[model samples]
Target: MKNLLYILVLGLFIYSCSSTKNRDFNKKEITANANDTVRIANDSLEYEIIVIEPGFNLFINSIAKPRGYHSQSYLENKNIFLVQEYNSRVNQPFNYNPNLYIQAINYDNFVDYGYEVNYMLYNYFVFFSREYNQRFSVPTRI
Candidate 1:
């Protein structure tokens, strides 16, 4: 009985130490939004990025082109709708990427315009897939 008890205690000690020895994470700490900081440390290079809070409009406008302006097709596929609208509605000639219209939805404050452009591209892709010997899935965008 004494020998059996010694073996059991030794086994438990070995198991406990071994289980915790291989763990990857040493420590993790998260600061509150007010504090607005993140810290990570490991064997690799330490990385830290400052948190900046800007208004949504300012952030969007910084990356966004002005409304009613367009970039050429060389940059992206041409937007026929924008071209037509520019021709008939504004009577202005411009060449721009269709993707810009997609980006415009967020910046232009035009929800309907964005949806229309998305629908047009989606249908155009579907129509092309049917006519041509090719297949394309609509991409999931962030």
Candidate 2:
């Protein structure tokens, strides 16, 4: 029982030490408004972002692009998705790769957008995937 207690304590200590968020987050007052944007820092990068504290339902109503913004062919094509594969063959257990792919978008295309437009678009797609499992591809085959 004593040995088990020591192991449990040691495991807890290790887990606490490994938590990056606990070490980096500052114990400071977070000031922001629901109708406004706020600045947040992680590591050393400071990002001026909006906090939409609602789920995807609200996100779809507020931030998502209209259905006709992208064509049906562009939405369904699989060739444009970039597959991110970085698993070690020898050290890690082998797993089947998903039919994942990504498209390289030109930033110049969105030149008229406001500052952080690219950042917002990036986040939008991320949430779109989590909420709807929707994927996108480049117009041209890579």
Candidate 3:
């Protein structure tokens, strides 16, 4: 009876450790997903929106725990010229106000990452004007 009890206890300890390790691994995977776009498990339940612009794809993925759903928005482009900083937390803390986060993306870097820039003629002119207003202003040297 003593030997049998010792074997049972050892088996339970091994099983418990294995289960705990699996749980820890799962948590790590979920935490890592925050960095990029993913088709979340139960993704249909998560809220997500993606916006595309000339330079990048803006992606916002948030989960409303109480509602058991997530929300996301994608705002592309470097049009947003403002910056703000905040503490980081789990489960999409940015949902409190996604616009600020959307504005943080560096669209130039997105282009550097091989994203194509498709500029209509008018858009090209407008972008150029903003980028080179001083040059455009100089008197032409005939």
Q: For each candidate, what is the lDDT?
A: 0.36, 0.42, 0.31
Give a tens-digit lDDT track for model 2, residues 77-137.
Answer: 3212321211121123334223322222333331233323333444445564566564444
Tens digits of per-residue lDDT, candidate 3, 28-105, equal 665555433322122443322233332211112222122212111111122211111211211244553443223332
After superposing candidate 3 on the true structure, give the runs of residues whose Cα lies further than 4 Å from its correct spot: 15-82, 85-142
lDDT: worst 10-residue window of model 2: 82-91
Q: Rank the candidates by TM-score, best first.
A: 2, 1, 3
Better of 2 and 3 by lDDT: 2
Report the Cα lDDT for candidate 1.
0.36
Better of 1 and 2 by lDDT: 2
Sorted on lDDT, best first, the list reads 2, 1, 3
Q: Which candidate is the best by lDDT?
A: 2
Q: For candidate 2, give the lDDT of residue 106.
A: 30
Question: Which lDDT tens digits does candidate 1 get at residues 30-92?
Answer: 222334322222324232222222222242245334433533331123334333332342232
Residue 98 displacement (Å), model 1: 57
**Under the 3 Å rule for N, CA and C atoms, how many clashes does model 1 have?**
1
Candidate 3 least-lDDT 10 residues: 80-89
